[model samples]
Target: MLADTKKVGGFLLLAAALLLNGCKEEKAEVGAAAPALAAYDLQGNPASLEKWQGKHVYLNFWASNCGGCLVEMPVLEKLSKEFGDSIVVVGINTDKEEMNIQALLDERQVSFPNVRDQLAITQERYQVIGTPTAFLIDPQGKLTGQYIGMLHEPELKAIFEKSRQKG
Candidate 1:
């Protein structure tokens, strides 16, 4: 009985360690290359961070039903227009249904390339816990900022200015 108990305890400890390893935390750290995950944009074109190489990138993770996200979409569009080709504002939509996402986009007139995160893979990689989470990537593709809530033009401008100094 003693030998059986020892074996069972050892097995349980090993199982716990494996489980914890599998749950390893993932977050986009500043000065680290962004995750190179692939997803489709609203136009069904394959999109990834690689496409925005050599450009400043603002990656926003949001969901259609998220209230804060609803307010930030237009702000992002304005940033895209003002920044022009100099910087890229990419939205990662976390909505489960493509149809609903399309409907929201149509209603909002969001002009930026909104990538579909149907499986939430990129969201998980970014450690996004809520809508309107934005990350700033410098020209060299290093993560510079991670904002977990609504972002305004002033704040964005500040981040861009700071990034310019760094790169």
Candidate 2:
């Protein structure tokens, strides 16, 4: 009985160690090339991150239910307009309900290219653990920076400038 108990304890320790290793955060390098992404636009058209190459891309992970996302969308829209064709801003909504996300976009007058991550696959791929996470990708398709909250205009502009410099 004592031998069996020891074996079980050892197994538990091994399992715990494996779990902790799995939970380690992946460190993504800034200026690293962006990974290929296949996701859908708000209109349900198939879109690829590669399509936005040769332009600075701002990718935002959002949800209709998130308050911060609500505030950030308009800011993103303004930036999108200011940047014009020089940059592309994409809002990837993680909301499972299509209607809710669409309604919010319409009400907010979100002008940027918006997408829906129905299965949250993009979230998992980008390692996005929270709403309002933004990734700035340079014209050469390299990741320049990541912002993880309500972004003020100045900070976003700084990231945009950094991406521009990468080109």
**Candidate with maximal lDDT:** 1
Instruction: Tell me the deviation in Å of residue 23 in model 2.
Output: 19
> Highest TM-score, which number?
1
lDDT values, one for every candidate: 0.78, 0.77
Over 8-109, each residue of candidate 2 has an lDDT whose tens digit, in order, gives: 999999998786445433334576766555468766787788778789889898887788888777778887887756888988888784356777778899
Model 2: how far residue 123 lies from native, Å: 0.7
TM-score of each: 0.77, 0.76
Pairs that collide, model 1: none
Residue 156 displacement in candidate 2 (angstroms): 1.9
User: Residue 122 error for model 1, in Å?
Assistant: 0.7
Clashes of each: 0, 0
Quote model 1's TM-score. Answer: 0.77
Q: Model 2: runs farther than 4 Å from truth? A: 1-29, 165-167
